[model samples]
Target: MPQTENQTQVTDRPQATKTAILVIGGAEDKVHGKEILQTFWQCAGGTDAIIGIIPSASREPALIGERYYRIFADMGAKEIKVLDVRDRDGGRDSAYLHYVENCTGIFMTGGDQLRLCGLLADTPLMNLVVERVRAQEIALAGTSAGAAVMGHQMIAGGSSGECPNRALVDLAMGLGIIPEVLVDQHFHNRNRLARLLSAISAHSDLLGVGIDEDTCAMFDSDRNLQVLGRGTVTIVDARDISYTNQNQVHGADPISIHNLKLHVLRYGDRYNLEGHQVIASS
Candidate 1:
């Protein structure tokens, strides 16, 4: 059953000063492994942090649940709860709300982003998630489909490697936990350069981040993003890309791409979103 408007009261937890949002492209187990676990350990302040997993995007609930259970366990999270947002009860169950309220960190699993958004959007659960991140200083992280839903505008639906036209692109409102930038996952593997470039061309003010698999870009409270894992995060900026025939194009028409800045960041490399500078070299 679809979620109703009113189910539970929004949480009023006090926010923390230091908060981090980790966005992973995919293949979390293969990409960072022990290091990823270690990062979570350090971010949560200990091995015994209260962690919650939202795997509503996955079609196979048992597989998704087990995958997260093992991942968190390997990361040394003692108290981990997997919230079943797909419950026929309409996502308003008291147990689900309780876990969301108390969790120190919430991780989103990769699958169908649209499914995940459908289950959480406009529900009291989503409101609590936003509140927890702002007020309680909860660390929110997502891999693949999980990563795609962090920004204000998400690529809820799009074709792979295809140059985006107005009709080819499908943008949906996201959780808005991260702002200004649009994120694309499995970037290199999927040859998503054209799609991201097209998105930047359409919205000149927004930044396009194409994250490779097995890698993560962690945005800190100070708006500094640090890259981690084996792969790279490519930042595409077409703010200066001059074009005249944007509206005349139809299917995969070539558009002039100029003044585009591309940055490939690796582990330990930090980029300042506010200043658009590479602070600490990887």
Candidate 2:
């Protein structure tokens, strides 16, 4: 129970302000003490929450969608619907559009990042989701592959359990919910530190976020990220890196870099994304 003083106030905002974004690592606890998911439920307006589950990322869309529907329903949500859009056309369905319009909180399930983007990226449905999120009108949560798409520079795929190398990671475009970051989920559990380092070497301008299993990096409207759950959030900041051979290297070769900053934050810890500062847990 790594609760912060103001963590429960996540949904408290001024009129017409933005809501929080919960970026969860894969395999968050569904039973016992579900701190992360519980936090998401409360941030979504609690008993009054009207939630939509987007399971397009999973191969078994209906199965995954129903799974989350039950999770929210059990939390006493006012209404819950699964938006199982498998193709771009499904994104435009009036039925789904209505759910996107009326839902107070939206949750995207984990699966393939490419599949999620292929199905919803640039579609009218995703466009509305973005619009509502940016306007501070809705709370949004995405886990695993869903977390990977929250950045402009996405880590599509790559190897793990290796030294930092130029080719140890793959890159792609993302949904840009938090454009300044490049998110990698299942971090420490999958030994993805090198994988994330390789990613930041390519795009040093964007902060690299490594979220561990069962953990969450909750971002507020002002870009302050707070950690929650059982694991840690690793941040890689290379904005001031002095050098890198990323451009000169070719295929699986070890990369050379300097001045890359990193921070490992646990539950109750906070980091300011705008200022790149750490607010250590008290």
- Best model per TM-score: 2
* Per-prediction backbone clash count: 3, 1
Question: Tens digit of lDDT per residue, candidate 2, span 1-282?
Answer: 443444454443212123889999999988766778777888788898989889998999998898888888898999998988988899898998888899888999999999999899999999999999998889999999999999998999999877789678889999999999999999999999998989999899999999999999999898899888778999999999999988988887888889889899987788998788998776
The lDDT for every candidate, in the order shown, is 0.73, 0.88
Q: Give the local distance difference test score of model 1.
A: 0.73
Task: Tell me which residue pairs clash in candidate 1.
Answer: 14-135, 15-135, 15-136
**lDDT per residue (tens digit) for residues 41-115 in model 1:** 456545767888888888985688777777777667868888877854546778878887877888788898888
Model 1 — TM-score against the truth? 0.86
